[model samples]
Target: MAVLAAIDIGTNSIHLILVEVDESTGATRQLRKEREMVRLGAGEALKKRRIGRKSFARGVEAIARFAGVAREAHADGIRAVATSAVREALNGREFVEAVRVASGVDVRVISGADEARLIQLGVSRGYPLHGRVACIVDVGGGSTEIIVADAERPRFLRSVRLGSLRLYEEFLAGHDPVDPNDYRRLQRHVERALRPLGRNLREYGYDVVIATSGTALGLAGADAASRGLPAGRVHGYELTAARLRALQRSLLRMTVGQRRRLPGMNPRRADIIVAGAAVLIGVLELLGRTALVVCDRALREGLVAEFLDERLERASQSGDPHAVRTEAVQEYAVRFGAGGEHERTVLSLSLSLFDQTRALHGLGAADREILYAAAMLHDIGYYVAASSHHKHSSYLIRNADLRGWTPGELMIVSAVARYHRRSMPKERHPEFALLSPEARDRVAKLAGILRVADALDARELGVVDAVRATARGGALELEAETAQEIDAELAAVGGKSDLLAAALGMRVTIRALQVERDVDQRAVAGY
Candidate 1:
């Protein structure tokens, strides 16, 4: 037997679960569970994209205490993962480093996609999904992850930015008793965001819907109390859409203080419960499902299951390490009508430039990979509209269901692709501004290189065969090997080299050199 502790660092709270796993049977027995409402993503922190001093302190203290508890329990191992709050924050790495110093545990900030995957894993452990197609919905403090799956594997996974705390802050925070106008606006926002999710759920078609997370459990408890049922164990409780709508209406009519006094209500969750209810009701209505089953297991429990699975050497159906990231990216690009000779040429040039300018850019292999993805997808926005295609590219990248990428990585790629053509990275752009200082710099550098590479193939005739970069005294020179004259490409480079010059802190000059080549080796190698 092995003892383990799993901590879920969430937007609204930090949760700890201690369990003892039997190696022989691969079964786990829960030892203890703890929750602290640190509200890491509360108020202006979410809007400003930074963790506040007070919240950061509270979060660190909570994790330290929890780590101490795990140590006291003689845990053999500890696994901690952070969700939307830390994942989206500009100072999220700062918070993670602080927690590590305070608790001696490294926190992994999971992407929305991974969060959804783990939620399904945890829910499946407690509630059997055998032979039944199920839709799992988890409404957290800062984001919601939805999954459509069967007994064998998940058919779809999606993470939306809407959550109880986020919705409250955005729409209903100021009003004690929700203003009618504010409530309508909130509903509209939720509906609009969930439209695509609704379509996916309809197409996948699930036999049952499952709801997890604190918000769901609290709402389920309240619903049970109202119906004169035992609210002690809410696990596996069936909450109908009609009853949920009624609960939402009643909660909205009451002030926070009044809601806090309700039977089975979690006093700590009173402020955001209404918004949570609205999100659940909207999802249920969208699926056209009459009821959803509440599961108490969520991310923390999922961590425990994963730990045990690793020890037992159990292979997960959906967790294939051999799957190629390029395959997923290529599929997504094709969906957006983005792949062709031009895109291929731009991708080759981008990789070549990134590799050749490594010393100047000071980037590593991981960043080079991000640049590869951004280059392949830079022009996908043309499918939407020719005008302002850069902006459209950013949106498509963010929304695409590309596997094997974290949310932060996707955001960086999106920002890089967005700035490949038009304006440089600035603090005014919300997407660009949301990134951390380090990430912003990375985007700027990668975008700068992308801009130059794209300009080299401006005419799309592939006039430039290859570019060799050499740094001189405070200046960079690019020699392009090609048989044809690249006057048009040279002019385009002149127009677009400003960003690169600023990034490298030097002047950039490019000239085409006449050369003969039997075949383009770089193009043939599929760079």
Candidate 2:
């Protein structure tokens, strides 16, 4: 069992969720949840691309208090992420450092795309997408993330700069009852932002539209209250477009103080509820759907799901660490149309080389796994274009949402694949430079091995059944067991062994051994 806390610092508020996870069964129970409206992006913060002094202080204080609560609960781990507000602010890193100093908690500022993916992960826990393609929309304070996905994976993911607080502050603030002109401008802004998303909706139609985050929950709660239904009972609630329109109209006509007095209303959200309703209603109309399913699970819940997933993955690593990673890599390779016998042959050779050179490289099983994944995916860039396919392969590996691999691991794997054919890891290369010194060294060593393995399969005929490496003094000699002549493969190795030699600080040489055809055939068959 493990206790975990996830905190989401947003433009309008900061949220915390404490979950107890059963490690053996992979079950999670919500222990507690908390929210505080700090308006971190209040006033001209978003407009100016900075957090205001007051908002910054409020955000720090709230995070410190939340950290205290998590510590009191004896959470095994706490993960905090800041969304669009801090992500876009110029001084966002400053705020993050301040929170770290005050609360002793590290905060990760995620990209809008990652935020969308996590939201979908969290929503899947509460509401199953089943076999249907569902468009999950998270109406956040600084941005809106839309993901079109099914039971398996997401098809489309996008983050628009439209949000309740963003729209409210940009167009509807300072108005008692929303000005008709300002309302029109807000609608126009929303329409423009959602136009591309609407195209996706038309292209990849959804079976259901799922809405998440506080804005959606508040809108659903308000709709339920107006219909004389139970209050705060909005989760899994199917809020219809017509009801949302009705509520939007009512909100536009009422003052903030009046809206605050309404039953089931959250006074903190009163001012921006109108804009929130507008964004949701726009999405519903675009989908041509009657209603949206409300999911209270958003970024914070997504964080919890992620924590549990990582924990479960770690637990599995003890038994068979490569099982999940291999599956995820193979799945991605197949998806990109890069899987075949040639890739299999290269993968086999890469692993053999990685295992054989363990003493020289001083890399462990984990590094071998990294080499395995990179070898399987090194040619994936051919899916994009044969020219500069290596560069394309790097991009795909970095961007593809492969499970069981952390962001850092993905970087290393991608770097290894990238350098399999092209230039070595240089400090000038942006992607290589971004990696830590340790990761950069790992990539260099692994890529050096992968290049030689790939070269051994240069003909894609798997002629070289196996290679035995001998390290003598400062030079390494490879004996290739094969019946057929391998002049081409030998030449390929000569060109590719430069990296390996440089990485291992040794001279490298390879030669093929010609045995009886029957004996060679037996060796190959055994391999």
Candidate 3:
């Protein structure tokens, strides 16, 4: 069993979870977990930037404590992610640097889009969705993530800056409010901002609302207490739309100090509970639902599930010989920002080119996997730096703790991507040396397919309709259909025919086909 720890550094809290993974049996179970509300965004909220004083110190202390616990738990792996607060802070680097120096932990700052996806994943794990269209709302101290998920996945996901802490700061910026006008005005603004979600809500035809984050859980706790409910039973608790309205009214009547003393209200959340309740109230009213099903799990669980899924797939492929090559590559494509359609176009061309000369190249499952991952992650380097982007892409893929990929698998993907551009696999490259002798040879063989795939879409249009492999004579024929004239693409391929020829022992011809109209490109890309 491999023990893995995931640390989530949120604006309002820091959480650590330790879990043991059994690779042999594909079993995972949590061992230990701890959560602390540090309010890392406390001072930053007033400055509109990160203030590396109290928040930074608190974060470091929390991490230090987590490190001791992780060590005692004997964690085999560690993964840390920073949420909206750190991402928005101008001096966020300083805080991260301080934490790293203090606790020896590297933190990944996930984008808001990624945050939304992870939150949805976490919510789904705790409460499996029954309805096809569901709205996932995570109201945090610094940001609110709303995901409109369909039968397929999230259709529209957005993270708004309307969090409880921010609202509290705005409302209490001055002296104590003389009347309820301040709270009412904040409610109106929140409703106005959330008006756009109605468009997607109506479009998706949603039937269920899923609520996550501490705010909802706290609300559920309070409501449960009011109704004489038992503790530790609110994970799947449902609040009817009407019940939620009544709770909001009761909470609104309390002052900040009063809210702090309420049952289930954390001392750290006293000032922000009102604002969080307001945000949820707005969502409830807009969706025309009186209650929401509260889920205790959020992004932390989502991240862990994603990690587990990746590890499970990797283990499955290791055990089975017939696993699909596209499984890993498509995931790589998603992390690399490659368009699904383009990746499919590239995959089709790559496989077509590989199949035509399999007799000479002798491509195996592992080789095919390398080809697919390379094709999927070929453009990831563009996100970091465009200049000499092939090297950048290699660096990013090699360093990224991509789920479902081992260090060796990441090396192959990186090496394949490295050769996707001008340079071929060199014997002296560090990444090439890291692979086993068999893998190094495979990388060289697979790089030929990647180079060809990269050149096939030289025009960057979704025009490459289909690719076919035909070996009639001593030569291999690569035939593809394009919507428009692909002279540049052909020219690009023309330049790389020799690399393919050298690897496959025969010259390759690139041709444009005109007789294909049956294939669904969308399905091929999993879109």
Candidate 4:
């Protein structure tokens, strides 16, 4: 088992969870858990939309302390994420950099929508939620996240600036013992804000409602304590709306200090606990649910699950029919700003040629996959430079850390993409030298087809529709199926047929045959 640490720096608190995890399945047994209330979104920083000096210092110190504990536990990796508070803060990056230096950990600030998704992942992955349709409600200090998802995927997610701290500051700033009129105003404001959910609740009906974050858990903990139950046995805790309203009523009549005296109430959150309760009740009313299931799992567990999934995917990289490898290869191409339409065309034409010429090359599915990936990424090197981008393409393809495909397979794809344009493959090329005589021959034949494909789409206009390669006598005829006369494409075909001819040991011919229009928007262009 690997030791993993996940740190969640929220607007109101910083949380660290250390676990010995099985990375492949994201299964974990918790080792140590820590929380520090720093109120990173408190006071003037909220108005300024930035982390204040005191809060920033506190934030850094908390992360450093947590990180130290994680390292002391010999954790394999630490993922530190900052939520809504840092996202709205102008000085968020500056504070993040300070924390990085102090804690040796880079802080990741996530959007509210992403925050909701992570919370969903945490509940689904970290806890035993099964595969039931779940509506998760996560209430933080600075914002509340509402998500409708199943056990596996999120269907809808929303984040609102109506968290406990925001509600306290916005509607009940100076109210002590919560004036009856002020409480009514708060309730009306909450109802109006969440009214939009009536449509979503009807559209995506949920099987069960799950509540997370300190507010829901704190109240649940208090409820459990009053009933002589263990507070730590909070997960899967079920609380009904009527019972929740009873607790909210008790808090409404007491001052913040008096509320803190309640069992399971933390002194730091006593003031805004009523607002948290209000948000939860608002969600229950909107969804017409009687009870909510509280989950101790939240964003921290989500981060760990996501991190492990990525690592497992990359470690077992292959062009398996699952296409995980193909997806990763495309991500690299997109990352470098390759033209989409051109890449698709080249890939289509090259694959078509590979299929039609199957009798001649005798390459396996694995090699054909290498050719497909190469065609998709042939021109990505243009992001570095337009001239001789073929060389750049090879370098990138050879160096790409794709999920699937071994080093030898990567070299073949890179080599084929490298020779798509200008120069012919030679004995002295180091990348070519790495391949065996048989593999080098395969690369040359694939490169020959790619060269013709790239030339066919030189204009970046979607002109050619279908392509076929036929063996006739001592020559290989390459036909372009198109409705419009493709003089430019044919002319390009003439100039780039030398490599094809050499690979096939015969002359190559090109012709355009008129055909009906067949176009796909996603199939516009590729090189």
Candidate 5:
């Protein structure tokens, strides 16, 4: 087991966790935990500036305490991050510098998308996520992280500034003027800002709605305990479609003091819990999810889990480049909903050609990895935009921040995706030249392999089951073993051979082979 510590300094609180993780199985157990209610958003609304002296000091003190917990745990690594309050405030830099000086911990200020991605990572790692389209909503003090995922992979991720602290500062300013008109106005603003998001989320219809963060978990935990449910299984705690509506009405009727005194309600969270619940209710209604499942894990656990998972994957990989590349591509293909057999066939063929023509292409292991990745993710862009899908693939590969991949490796994958169809790499293209001379050469070579492989799966079906490559004289022969001869796939492969020939300086020969009964035949071609 490896120990990793994560500290999250947010607008409302500072939290730390010491997690003991089993690297081989991706199992995580929390050893120790600590949190402080710093209220870093205090007076930000009245001042229209940032967190003031008292709040900043409170945050620094919290960090100092967390540093002690991390050290005592003998943590192998520690990740300290700050969210919306620090990112939005003018004096955030000063506050972060203070924490660094006081606690010797560098704080990473994360963007909203980064926050949402991390939140999803944490929740998915902690839960049993199998074949469900999970929509995770983390309603925090300064931001709300909304991530829509299909099982273990993220589909749509976003973060909004509609949070408990922001709402409290805007509407619940003074207790005296908390009139019905003021409440109605706040409601209209929230509904309007959410309308655009609601419209865009129609295609990504979610099956299970998972709520995370302290406030969301508290609501779900309290509600579940009220109904005589299990304790920690608050995660995936179901609030039925009808029950949730009633809860919303009940929450709106209760005052802050009344909420504090309610059974299972945390006194510290009573003031902002209403605002958090409102946002979650809005998202649930918009997404048409019948029940909301609460997740106890979120951003902090995500950071630790990621570190643990990487260590495990590296240990399992055992330094085989081919194994590592294949594992990565296979995981990605499964996550992105690509046909597994089709990807395997394409990869087998592309790698064979790459190895056979190494002298012609003059590429290395890295280049081969790029080719495999491009083959696996060739259709991922279809998930985002279809018209200019190649370009979309390039953008996503470049910017998605995939783990275990270097920037140089990502560039090669992006270039391969870009050149798979329509346009080829130009002399003046900016991203193309960013690669080193050796990498550029590898990109051109691997792009040829990707183009041919992707074209072979034009129908997006698992027709081609196997492939082989052979070098005869000055020609390269590719033989594909198929259950049936896919005419369209062959036509597509034939069209791409001209470009492949121009780039690889060789004649391309392709042929289909047949099998009898269950016996698989070896694809054959000669030059």
Candidate 6:
């Protein structure tokens, strides 16, 4: 047996693991797994495309602490890696040097595809797939890595920028009690982002799916999924999508405070649970798999295996073009300071309204995703020139080298961003006329929702909270829930809702609902 330690510095948190491995039997015993949320990707990480001073300090501090713990455990050698945020940060190298000096642990920043290969090694050692077709999915804070493996080697792999903390802060922040519509919208966004992967998964079918992440652990460990499991079975807990969705819905109904008190809920992950659910459910939907086995073994475990066995290493390089493209697009947006609170809040509102009023528009999940992407990228044109930014946005989006999107889908995202603040969609418009009839309609529908969402956050004053949309007597009723006055938001929505009204053939009415301040979790006994 060999004693070893591993560290993973992720976008959302930092992790350390100490383990003893028996080489002859290929069995491993985990002595300890420690995690702390440094949130290295928060603050300026995403918005400014660099690790902020405060977050950088916290990250270095966390690494030093993890190193100290490994020493206490008498670990032979500690291997560490930084994923997602660090690799993309401008000052990422600076922090890496600090970590080396403070902790004496040299940390390597691995690429998404490389991360997938390591994950495969880690999972195989822990679960032993037995040469069957299996899919290993590791959902990190800023990225999700998926690998399809036969008994010996990987068949295919892909990584996407759909992480729980990133999604939570970007799409559902400040919503104390998340609206059901927003949750559904987040699901659609994930589904859309993974649409290309869905096609690949269909081609290379698998016998089983495996997941490794805090969100998966939290969801699988919940009473709903783990109520009657055997002792020490958390590593291989089989969780059904239906049960996971049920837990997600239940969590959505409760606030952060209420969720923290629930048994099996990780208090550190309470806030980002919804975003994590999005990634899990998205993968499930894409694979057409009903359930996935949870693996407590993760990147850290993979790192240990790598140190002990060089034969475990596979895959060509650390990066994939598609994964890199996703990062580039996000970085391009932040370069213009386009991904502020206003853009994110508007995206949530747009998605909420689109989902709730689906009956009126007759749009499906794919169309809903277009709305979300548009909401995220709509304001990016302002980076070019403030005047007529909507037109410029259309041009910039169309010109960007986006990956994992078909030509038609890219055009749809471009069209939606274009029409977000401009004249109504018309057959005479040059770009609008290029799409097929169905695609054109989708663009119009998504753009209409985006208009209303943009209006709700007009001037970047987010007074609106939850929104519910329903059709009544040739009028669309949109009820908003907030503690602050929404006079400006309402006034802005009036002008912006014109396109929405025209698209749905109904006038829009904006009203307020009194915010619910309390979640009576008295029935929920604390753990």
Q: Give the best candidate by TM-score.
A: 2
lDDT of 4 by residue, 1-527 (tens): 69989999998888888767543222244566678888787775666798878878988988898899999999999999998789889988898899999989988889998999889878774343323478889999888999988655799999988788778867776788988888888899888889987798669867889899889988998888788876544666799999899989989999988887887776567878988899999989988899998876789878876776676567546434334765676567657755244565676677778878888877777777887788878877876788889899899989888876688889999999999988899989887888899998998899999999888866544467668788989888988886555788899989987888898898989998886541211110110
The TM-score that candidate 3 achieves is 0.59
Return whichever of 1 and 2 wins on TM-score.
2
On lDDT, the stronger of 2 and 3 is 2
Regions more than 4 Å wrong, model 1 = 314-527
Model 5's alpha-carbon lDDT is 0.70
Write one digit per residue (lDDT tens) for candidate 3, span 1-527: 68888888888778887766544322344556677777777744535776557667777888877877887888876778998778888877887887888888888889989999988776654553423467889998788999987423577799988877777777643433213888778888898789987876666667788888778877887788788774334656787767777877777777666766777555456567778888888888888876788776778877786786676577557765323333444455455444233454565567656656677777775666666667767776766666777888888878867545677788888987887778666778887877788887777778777777778777554345556667768777787675445677778888866656666677788887754322211110100
RMSD of every prediction: 24.8, 21.5, 19.5, 21.5, 18.1, 23.5
Q: 1 or 6, which is superior by TM-score?
A: 1
Q: Name model 6 segments beyond 4 Å from true.
A: 21-28, 224-233, 311-527
Candidate 3 achieves a global lDDT of 0.70
Residue 493 miss distance in model 6 (angstroms): 69
Backbone clashes counted, model 1? 0
lDDT of candidate 5 at residue 12, scale 0 to 100: 75
> What are the lDDT figures for the candidates, one per model?
0.81, 0.80, 0.70, 0.79, 0.70, 0.74
TM-score of each: 0.60, 0.61, 0.59, 0.60, 0.60, 0.57
Candidate 6, run of 10 with poorest lDDT: 518-527
Worst 10 residues of 1 by lDDT: 518-527
User: Model 2, 1-527: lDDT tens per residue?
Assistant: 67899999998878888876544333344567777888888889999999999889989999999999899999999999999999999999999999999999999999999998888777764564424578999998898899987644678889999888999999998687899999999998898889877766789967889999888988887888888875565656898888889888888889998888888787678888988888888888777889888876778877886786676566556666445666577668757655443565576667767768888889887787788788878988877888888889999988878767887788888999999996877898876989988888788899998899889878664556567798987899998776556788899999999889998999999999864321100111101
Mind giving the per-residue lDDT tens digits that candidate 5 earns over 272-382? Answer: 776777787778778876777776678887777567556647764687554454456546645655423345446556766676777777777666667768876665666
For residue 159, give model 6's deviation from the true position in Å: 1.2
